[model samples]
Target: MIRPRHILRVFLLTTLLTTCLTGLSACGFVGFPGVYKIDIEQGNLVTQEMIEQLQPGMSRRQVRFIMGSPLVEDTFQPDRWDYPYVIRNGPDIIREAQVRIFFEGDSLVDVTGDYLPSWANPNAEPQGSTESEETEEAKES
Candidate 1:
């Protein structure tokens, strides 16, 4: 004894529910549009300026003041301090960098990893060459 109007309402509701379920499932497969993804940053952020300020023979206290506390300080390698940084946007990594500072006793000896001080750059123009060039120019004058 169902009326025609009741049957139509039920059919419409069922169709609407099915469509909603299908759309929600599709959203699971291909993330919902317009969703905001946050950029996540972690660990010490060492910049080029920080690296440039480093100099060999600096005291451990001076190095720490310039570079900040390290992210990893291994007990086995007490002389080495590791600074690692990462930036991620959702599931993708945007950037990753690391710097390892080594010390001999309480004196900073070496620095390595993604960034290096100007003194440590192998491809940098030699300081001696620039001085020699300046002297040659003066002699020519």
Candidate 2:
């Protein structure tokens, strides 16, 4: 036989159990609202526009002026300059770009890395070299 007091107690227990289950389920999301995190940029942020300004014949001073000083300069490899850029949004990495420039003697010779220069293409000809090559070919013929 269920009395009114027993019914009241059962209802209270059911309500408490539902509340506990709801709270436990909500524990998965612990983040607060209205909070914002800023993205962090590290190392040299080399851009395509900056790379486009670089010419093969540009001096070290000129390259430094255009692309800024390299992040890593090895004493062993004085002619090799490495420019690396990394973006971080909290714990996750947003993007990374690495550009390596090689110099022969004092002149910038070539660039090879994960990034492609703006003017780097098989059909593209560097400034002054093509004209000199054409003149040389004519002379040879």
Candidate 3:
């Protein structure tokens, strides 16, 4: 008893609903863009090799020749350097590296503010100490 028009209408309705459902599946979706990118591999992280190659007495020009421009240098001391790097996905990823060097006199004695942590606490000293040789030297002097 179904008419041809009624059958056509049902078929069209089902088709429209299926298409709408498929499209909506993507429209209402969120967090899916970066969902597959949750894992951040630490393998891409660079090591201190950059700084290790720099000898204590190397000049700024020599340092630059070896390590390129620094990422950061100290503001006040202008002798300590700091490098930071991070690596994300492969091609569609985030990767960066930083370098710092300090100087003494005209020669590069120490690396200072290259382009990072320029405002770090100046009073803070690195870990481990057996009383500075300066203290002993001063006492003897």
Candidate 4:
């Protein structure tokens, strides 16, 4: 048969466990809080409104008027303009893009890309215009 000392030991163990659980529950011991932000330094996300301002038939000069100078331009691929921006949520975490704009002659032709995630294809060729033309197409079709 169990002695009274055994009953006391069990009671002490249960009380210790309950006290520890209660203390942990009261403190910030679970589920870390998250922070949200906007207007990143490198990733100033150009809004859709800005893109909507651009039209299929807009000239390269017009696109410049809308989006400002690009962040990068290739020496060999002058038709390709890259707008790179980044947003840092915290250390080691970032959201960014180099929104590529491609031109054929002087007409703004296509969006090369905007890579936002780490897993996306960073080197996907700008979407349109395989050949850089000498003159802008007089009118878009």
Please provide TM-scores, in order, for all candidate models, with all chains considered together: 0.70, 0.59, 0.36, 0.48
Identify the superior model by TM-score, candidate 1 or candidate 4.
1
Model 3 Cα shift for residue 52 (angstroms): 3.9
Best by lDDT: 1
Candidate 4's TM-score: 0.48
Candidates in order have lDDT scores of 0.93, 0.84, 0.58, 0.67
Candidate ranking (lDDT, best to worst): 1, 2, 4, 3
lDDT of 4 by residue, 1-141 (tens): 999999999999999999998988875544346744444476335665676576565788898888887777799999888787776654444666667777888886677455322223455454454443423453343
On a 0 to 100 scale, what is the lDDT of residue 75 in model 3?
A: 78
Q: Is candidate 1 or candidate 3 better by lDDT?
A: 1
Q: What is the Cα-based TM-score of model 2?
A: 0.59
Model 4 root-mean-square deviation: 13.7
Lowest lDDT 10-mer window, candidate 3? 112-121
Which segments of candidate 1 are over 4 A away from where they belong? 1-30, 128-141
RMSD values, in order shown? 5.9, 9.2, 9.7, 13.7
Give the candidate order by descending TM-score.
Answer: 1, 2, 4, 3
Query: Tens-digit lDDT track for model 2 on 1-141?
Result: 889999999999999999999897785466445667689999998877788787787788888998899999999999999999899976779999899988988888777666556465455567799889999999999
Which of the two candidates, 1 or 2, achieves a greater TM-score against the reference?
1
The number of the candidate with the highest TM-score is 1
Q: Which is better, 2 or 4, measured by TM-score?
A: 2
